[model samples]
Each structure stands twice: as structure tokens, then as C-alpha cells.
Target: MKNKEPWYATTADGVPLVAAVPLVDAQEEEEEIPVLVVPPVTTSEVVAFAAAAETTDHPQPSAPTLEESFQQQLSLKEVPTSTTRREQKREFKREWRTMKRQAKQEWRQMKRDAKLEARALKREFRSEKRALGRNLSDVKQDLKQEKQMMKDDAKQIKWDAKSKIQEKKRELHHMKRCMRKNMLAGTFCCH
Candidate 1:
């Protein structure tokens, strides 16, 4: 028998090739030869075969684990407003900051208004105090003038009364002197 070249059959879908070994002409071609040894397969071929076998046997769908179910529930409940949850949170924060800033500005404005009102009231009080002070000083000055006039009138009346008393005393003295003289000359000059 002549030795033949090693035959390589093209494999389908990355499957390993299987070559038929030629035997000596003892039995007809229709007879089957029992295979005693398996063909040597590469490591890559074994891995490919394992992967193909694993793919052929479809695994049954198992129930979700606790972590996976929790993750899925979180994902489902995360966004209900069509927007993302992070975006919604950012919007909420921005609105809150705006409200806070507005409130602070309003508070500051209120304080400024209060300060202005207080200053106005203080100015009004000061003006009133000044006016009252002027009025009090005027009244005091008027009272002083009135008191001086009254003192001058009292002094004038006292001086007039003293002069009148002196005149009356002088008149009395003169009349007494005259009567004495007439009595002394009354006997000799009876006419």
C-alpha cells in the first residue's frame, strides 16, 4: 500500500477537523473501521469546543438576586419626572438658594428701612427738643424782664412815700414856730 498525504477537512463554525484514516485493502469500503484513538486536539480547539458545548446547552433563567432586584428597583424609581434625578436635585438646590437669597435681601431691606425710620424719628425728636428749648428760653427771658419792671416800680413808690413824709414834718415845724412868735408879741401889740 502507498502512503497517502495527511487529509485535512474544512470545519464549519470553528469546529475542530476530523480526518478519516485510510486502511489496507482487506475489507470493502462499505465496512466501518472502529476508532481506537482520538485525534490530538490543540488547547484552543478544546476551549472552542467547551464554549460551543456550553452555548448549545441553554441555561434556565434563574430568579434575580437581592442586590440585582434592589438595583433595578432603584433605577425604576429614580426618575419619574422625565428629567434625571441629579438634575432635579440640582434644580431644587438652585431654587432653594434663590429663595434664601431673596429672603436675605428682603431682611436686609427691612433693616435698612427700619434704620431710616429710626433716624427720621430721632431727627424729629431732636427738632422738637430744640423748639421746646427755644420756647423755654424765651419764656424765661420774658419773666426776667417782667420781674425787673416790677422791682423798679416798687423802688419808685417807696421813694415817693418817703419824700411826702418829710414834707409833712417840715410843715408842722414851721407852724409851731409861727404860733410861738405870735404869742410872745401878743400883750404889747394887741392891735
Candidate 2:
């Protein structure tokens, strides 16, 4: 045997590159194990090599986690038989029916609420219209009362002026009659 020692690869920074175990122990095994003497490469050379070797199309896959492995194994092992598939289909149908029923009930409730709101709005509108009508009528009544009062005042003023004119005409007639009597008597006794 030429060499019986274990081989490993490392960088210049004393960091081990490969951590693989040797297939045969150096002390017990007598077979010759060829040591792969790797040249010491710098970190920059390793980075450049990795960059040159990397491809954009094919990406390396990461190792699966324990939970992910367990789920994958379960999925592979638990193949759905015909009976199990039928049961799943029935369960899905039941769930779909319940969902559809819930949706229909919710839709009907929404429609009912909308109708009630519309009715309430209509009632409010009608009441507002009635109130506006009552207010308009009250305004019209007030205007009529004011017009009647103005007409009555005008009539009273006209009657008072007519009475004054009548009294003035009667005074004028009596004065004329007195003047005529004095003139006829031709005496101071008319005083």
C-alpha cells in the first residue's frame, strides 16, 4: 500500500472545504486509498468559478424540511381509492349545498332590507310633501287675511271723506240762504 491516510480539501484560511468521511479507516484498513491533492484556491477564485458555472435557466433545488417531507410521503402513500373518492365527492357536494343555501339566505335578507329601506324613504318623502303643502296653505291664508284688512281700511277712509264733503256742502247752502235773507231785510237784525 502506498498511502493509508484520510484525505480532505481546505482553503487558505484553514477552513475545511469537503467534510465527507473516508470509506475505510486508515489504522485498520490495509488497502491503499488515493488522496486527491487539491490545489489551494482563494475565495475570489472560488466565487468566480461558482459564478461561471451558474446558469439562469436551471436553479438548484433546496432540501425539503421534515414537515414538507412528511406531507409528501403522506400524499404519495394515501392514494384515493374509488370508495374514498366517492366519499370525498359526496362531502364536497354537501358543503357546496350548504354554501349555496347560506348565499341564498343572505341574498334574500339583503333584498328584504333594501325593500324596507325604500319603503321608509317613500314614507318620509310623502310626509315631507304633506308638510310642505300645509305650510303653503297657511301662507296663503295669512296673505288673504292681510289683503282683506287692507280693503276694509280703504273703505273706512273713503266713507270718512264722503261724510266731510257732505257737511261742507250743507254749510255752503246755509250761508247762501242767510246772505239772501239779510239782503232782503236790509237791516242789522240779521246779526
Candidate 3:
């Protein structure tokens, strides 16, 4: 008997090659082999198996006791819940009214301050203008007094000059009369 390979041989064109082989011979059986016959599992059995496998891999923690849950509820109840919609609306209106009043007061105060400042500035400007006018008037009076003094000085000088000229003319006339009297008495030279 010869050992045969499991796969068949193929040619270049992909056709299976047929070969001459000897046939297998059958012998009478002596002892029978035992066979294992397993039954098919149902859906419930498969689910139970999966659950048991998951639990063994990762264990879950136990739930809280009733006493612990009751204590937690009591702690939550201690905090107040006073923020209702109606209360919030009332608070918002009160704050808005206060803000409006404060803004009006501030605006009035600013206007009053501006008016007072303007009045003070106007008074200061008027005082300065009056002082300037007084100074100009004083300067004009001084100039007038100086002009009058100069005119008087000029008139006095002119009168003094005229008097000196008249005295010189009278002295010349008296000398001419004395010369005429000496010529009549024959006491003066003719040349």
C-alpha cells in the first residue's frame, strides 16, 4: 500500500491530472468507538452563560442601604429654594427703579455744577474788563494833562520873546532922538 497526498495535482492549463491509484480495502471491525452526543443549548441557557462570564470578569458594587438614602434626602431638604419667578421679577423692578432715580439725581447735580461754574467765569471776565477800561481812561487823562502843560509852556515862551523885541525897538528910537538934538546944537560931526 502507498501513502497518498491530500491535494490533487493540476496541469499548466488548470485541468486536474488523473493518475492510476490503488483502491482502499475494508476489514471487519472488532471493538466499537464511543461517540460524544452533545445537545443544543437554548436561548435562556446562552444568556445565563454570558451573564456569569461577565460577572466573573468584573465584579459590581453593592447598592446603598435604605438608611443612607434617607440621610441623603434629609440633607438635600435642608437647602432652601426661595428663587421663584415672581420674586425674581419683583427684585428686578426694584433695582430698575433705584437705578433710574440715581441717574436723574446725578444728571441734575451735573447741570447745577455747570451753571455755577459758568456764573463764576462770567463774573471774573466782567471784573477783568472793567479793570482794563479804567486803566485806559487813566492813560487818556494823563495824556490830556501833558498836552495842556505843553501848550502853556509854549505860550509863555512866545510872550517873553515879544517883550524883549519891543524893548530893543524903544531903545533904538531914544538913541536916534539924542543924535538929532546934538546935531542941532553943532556939537556932533556931520560925517
Candidate 3, 1-191: lDDT as tens digits: 23434234568997555433323321232333233333445799799999998778666788989999999999888966559999889989999999999999999999999999999999999999999999999999999999999999899889889888889888777777778878788676342
- Tens digits of per-residue lDDT, candidate 2, 84-160, equal 87798998999999999999999999999999999999999999999999999999999999999999999999999
- Which runs in model 1 stand beyond 4 Å of their true positions? 1-83, 187-191
Q: How many pairs of residues collide in each model? A: 0, 0, 0
Error of 2 at 137 (Å): 2.3
The TM-score, computed over Cα atoms with residue i paired to residue i, of candidate 2 is: 0.48
Q: Candidate 1, overall lDDT?
A: 0.79
| Leading candidate by TM-score | 1
Relative to the true structure, candidate 1 reaches a TM of 0.53
Error of 1 at 63 (Å): 44
Worst 10 residues of 1 by lDDT: 29-38
lDDT of candidate 1 over 1-191, digit per residue (tens): 33344455556775546655555342544454443334767899899999999889777899999999999999989856738888889989999999999999999999999999999999999999999999999999999999999999999998898889889888778777777777887633222
Q: What are the lDDT scores of the predictions, listed in order? A: 0.79, 0.82, 0.76
**Off by more than 4 A, model 2:** 1-84, 186-191
The order of the candidates by TM-score, greatest first, is: 1, 2, 3
